[model samples]
Every structure is written in structure tokens, then in C-alpha cells.
Target: MNEFVYHPSGKYLFVATGQGRVEIFKMPELELVRTVAAHSGQSNCVALAVSPDGKRVAVGASDALCFIWSIHETICERNLGRLDYHVRAVAFTYDSQLIATGSEDHCIDIAYVNDGSRVHEIRLEGEVYSAAWHPQQLILALHPRVILVNETVSVYDYLATPVESDLRNKNAHIHCCAYMETFRNDSKYPN
Candidate 1:
């Protein structure tokens, strides 16, 4: 199983495989949450990003499409159609208002979290290997190679289109992400 992204909440981590399924695992305790059939074929669950607030997740699989799933209630809440380009990395802006995705397409696309509406697309000269939202700043990352990127964990304000951002970027990847609040405050909650 190829675990792509571990959300800040720590309540869930996304595991992708060539098996065509994106599996969610409740963290720390390593509890199994649910497995969503992520793509149409056995495409590698190559890239994934979770919204700020922990209510939604965006995963890339099966071609160049990214699907946004609501984790609040589960059961396939909504589908953000084919993104057209094959994404190599993805991240959410602080406040969760926008999402930044980087691709071999050499473009970074930012979209409204609620409607998948394109906000801005930044062109990268080289293929982006990974990306993330800056935890406290408006700047978004495109495959950040640094080891300790300090950013905010993603959460959501669920509404009309589905979700909204809290505007936090936490420097974390699929395996290292842990809810900042939980670790900082020692909260029992998922954070």
C-alpha cells in the first residue's frame, strides 16, 4: 500500500496503491476508516492533499484527474471532475479557501475549495514533484524539498459547494503530517 498523505488531524491518513483504491486510516491507533475506490483503473494513487479543518480530501488517481471527497459524512459526497493534467503534487492554501496542485503539465492550479473554480494557475518551468500550502502565508508550495516545512494543517468549513479553507498551511507530507493543535496542546480530540 502506497500511503500518499497523512492529514493534520491525524484521525485519518490516505493510503493509495496500484490497486485502484484510496484507503483511509485513523491515525495513532492505526484504525481503518474506509476505502474509496479512487480511480477507474489501477492507477497509482500518486498524489493527495487534505483540506484545512479535516473535512475533505483531494486525491489524484487514474489519469490526470483529482477527486475531492468529503470526510465529514463520507459516502462520496462530491466529485471534482477531471483536472485534465496529471498532478504530481497537491496542497491547500491557508484558510482552505484555495487549493494548489502541481503537475507534470508544468502548471500549478489554484481553485476555490467550495466550487473547484479556478483561482489562479502558476506556470512552473519544471515538473513539480510535490507541493503544499504555506501554513501562515498566502504563498503556496510546489514540491517543496525542505525537510521541516512549518505550515498549518487543513480543515474545512463545509457549505454550498462542499468546503472552505481555514487558511493554514502546515509543512507536512503524506507520512509526517500531524495536527498541530493536537501535538501543541495535547488535545484528546482529532484537531
Candidate 2:
């Protein structure tokens, strides 16, 4: 993705290098307004999803840690609850109250935004490359092609055990499932 933000007020962009730095500049003029250190290591695998209103920034790393970077504070204030899985994909709920991470570990780490705490650890099968919550429903979408995984999508309540099961195949392997959102879902998936 191009590292820039454009606007009619003026063309602008923020170039974020995975190497813990970000540079912002105007279009054409390329005037630099800010040069800030953004994070550690190559942020390429990093999952950053900004709230729709542009208020909160959710960043997850290979370390199995999810952080809620509060932008209003002008500093990287990480709301914690370091998960034990790899985060493959990160997204915010419609209200941005819940942060859902799909990982390689056959699970999703559904967390509350305010405190960055996990509300439920949703488990699935195979390598969870992509995951997303229904904007209105509590149902979570799992890639049906996850190798050896039953072609069933799991719908989980906020904290209780999953309620739907007619969609699963029998004899699904318990091991070799994805863990954590880093690779696709939450950081804790067993892969």
C-alpha cells in the first residue's frame, strides 16, 4: 500500500516503514510535517486498523501482543492483554467497541477496545488466514479451505461456549490448527 493520505484541503500522506518510523508530507511539495518513530521491527506483518472515526489504532505484532494505540494522546499508549497466539488479521467491530483478530491458530481473539482485553477466545480449524465478524450478527466467518479443517464456521457468544455445530465435519484434527491473529486470527492458535 502507498504510504500517504490525500485530501481536498491538500494532498497528504504518511509513509510508514515497518522499521518503527513514519514520515508525513504534503503532495507535490513533499514537505515533511512529522517524522516519528512508529514501532519496533518490520511492521509489514503488523496489523494496524484505525477506527472508522479515526480515533483509535489497533496494532498487533508477531509477539502475540495486541495494542490499542490511543492517537489523541500523541504517544503510543498500548492497552494490554498480550495474547498467546499469532494475529493474522485485525478488525474493529461496527461500534469499534470490539477488536477481533483472526489468526493462524484456529482461533479468534475477540477483545474489548477500551481496555484491550480478550472477551472470548473463538476456536476454529486449520490455518485461519482470514476472519471477520458479521457487522450485525455475532457470527464469525472462517475460511472454509483451511486444510483438514471442517468446512464449518463457528458462531460464538461474547464469552460462552460456541452454540452452533451442525456445520462441522466429524474427525477434525485437534492439532495443526492456527493460533493467534498474527498469521490470520488470534495469536494463540496452536500452529
Candidate 3:
């Protein structure tokens, strides 16, 4: 398995494998329940994310596509078409209405989860390694594969507009990002 995530319900574990398959396992027992082929040609499943609502799982593969799997049915729900290069990261919005996929193509494409229609496309300065949505809002933070000069994680508003100056982090390569809780709209920290 290349990447694995526990469902938000804590009842199942989703594992993405090098064989382009997603293995679903029952929690506590760790018993394998089912396996769904996520990609063709044995392309490595590089990234995986379970929606916060626990209804779906998104798997990104070296095939340059992202597949949304049904948690209840254990099936390939929908696929976000070819992304141009190996998909490196996948993330779901706070409400699970959208999914964001980051690829080596230097693009973060946000698509609606309901029908797999693209909502927005965010082009980055470098290859994106990770992406995370704000806990209570449509905001997203992306960590690109950085050179020393562009080490900061880029934050964007709901419209995919860059807002890096609003929330700045310096002096470290942000391998990943997450929100422990919701952020308040205030003078210093506005959501």
C-alpha cells in the first residue's frame, strides 16, 4: 500500500496500493473487506483522501487521474479525467462537496463531488505536494514542491484566488497542512 486513510466514521480504513487498487478494511479487526481497482496499467496509487463526511474516498494515481470511490458500495463512483501528469495529492473540502487534486503538472483542480464537474483550477509556481481545506470554510492551503526561494505554503480563498499574504508561513518546507479546528474571523485572523 502506498497511502492509507481511515474513514471519518472510524469504521473502515482505505488503502491505496501500487497495483492501482484501493483496499478497504474493517477497523479494529483490520480485516480486509474489499478491493476496488482504481486505475489501469498498475499505475501506482500515490495519494488518498477520505471525505470528511465519510461518504467517499478520493484516490490519486500515477496515471494522472483521480478516482472517487463509494464508501458504502465499494465501487468506483466517479473519476476526474486525466490531469496531465502524475497526481501527487488529493483533498476534500470541509463539506465534501468538492475535491481538489494536485499534480506534477503544477495545477490544483477543484471538482464538484456530486458529478465530477470542475469548479476551479489553481495553477501553482511548482509541483504541489499536498493540499488541505480549512475546517469550516472553502479555503484551501497548498504545499508545492518548493525551491528554497518559494518555501511558503500558498493559501487560497473559495474562489481559488491566491491569498498568500493573508496567512504566511516561512522557513520550512510544508510537507502537509491541517486545521485542528475552525478558524475565527477576526482582525488578525480572518477566515
All predictions: root-mean-square deviation over Cα? 13.4, 10.5, 11.2
Q: Which of candidates 2 and 3 is the stronger one according to lDDT?
A: 3
Clashes of each: 30, 40, 0
Which has the greatest TM-score?
A: 3
lDDT of 1 by residue, 8-95 (tens): 7666778877756788888888788787877766576677878777777877754777767787766454444535666667677767
C-alpha-based local distance difference test score of model 3: 0.76
Order the candidate numbers by TM-score, best to worst. Answer: 3, 1, 2
Better candidate number, 2 or 3, judged by TM-score = 3
Which stretches in model 2 have alpha-carbon errors above 4 Å? 1-17, 20-38, 42-45, 134-139, 142-145, 149-191
Per-residue error for 41 in candidate 1, Å, reads 3.0
Every model's TM-score = 0.67, 0.58, 0.77
- Model 3 alpha-carbon miss at residue 93, Å: 0.8
RMSD of 1: 13.4
